[model samples]
Target: MRKIILSASVSLDGCFEGADGGLDWHLVDDELHTHFNDQLRGMSAFLMGRVNYELMARVWPDADADPSSSGPEAEFAGIWRETPKIVFSRTLDRAGPDATVMREVDPEAILELKRRPGGDMSIGGARLAARFRQHDLIDEYRVYVHPVILGRGRPLFEPSDDRKPLALAGTHTFGNGVVLLHYKSD
Candidate 1:
């Protein structure tokens, strides 16, 4: 069965976004962006929250059309457009092509998807990842930790009553001040 990987760019302080709901601090330069493209290109599908899906749909769909788009940016645009996406939303009535809007996260349904013949799936959005964590569905975690401290912002992992241990799978540092820490559930 394909694995469910929860991928996110977080801060050194363990925050995903700032108080104003911005990720300007993320140091996603060419090296990191290319790494993202390489990592996501092989995924069978993306599982994301409505907010994250909408945010990506707004920019990535036509990002390559812009003359100013960099090589990595254009590459990611195509990858994002071609990849199948499953959006979890209660408010969204529909989604774009190659996308499905789910009313909620169904663990059995996700497991069924994993059982099918395909590459691993990537899960986005902190809240949605938390839900997957609650169900113990995530098989791996690919965290890109940037060199910044958002002292105040939404944390990557919300406070939980239970503790889940992870074993380090691998680590890589990019030219930019970002590090990819791959971990697997223990």
Candidate 2:
């Protein structure tokens, strides 16, 4: 079965965004950005919430405008264009090219996608990731923990009926104090 991985960059305080819903504070440095892009290279498709998808759809294409550009922004632009995206939203009617808007949280869809012969699927939004976790569908957890602490903001996991222990698979600390932690459901 294809794996479902949840990858996110979070603050040390366990928040995905700052108090103002601004991710500008959690900027990934050049080295970390390169590392993140390398990690994303293995994903066959992305499953994300409407909010995250909208934000990414708006920014990445603009970044891809110039092929001559170098760095994570450019790399992200190129790779994102090719990567398949499935946006889960009840309100969004349409998405840009390369994205499919999904209204239902169907387990059958996930099961079918997992059975297909392809690269791994990745869940990108905190809420979406939590739902997958609750459903016991996620195969792996990859958290890039940054040093800064955003006292309050969106959390990785909300109160839910499903809670499972996870075992650490590996961990690596970046020079900028960002720790990449990999885990599997225990």
Task: For each of the candidates, give the backbone clash count.
Answer: 0, 0
Candidate 1 weakest lDDT stretch, 10 residues = 26-35
Q: At residue 92, give the lDDT of candidate 1.
A: 91
lDDT of 2 by residue, 1-186 (tens): 899988898888888877788888775778888987898887899899999998888778768577655678798887888899999999989887788998977888888999999999889988888767757889999998888888898777776776588999999988888999999977
lDDT of 1 by residue, 29-70 (tens): 887888889999999999999999999999999899999999
Q: Which residue pairs show backbone clashes in model 1?
A: none
Q: Rate the local accuracy (lDDT) of all candidates.
A: 0.93, 0.85
The estimated TM-scores of all candidates read: 0.98, 0.93
lDDT, candidate 2, at 159: 64
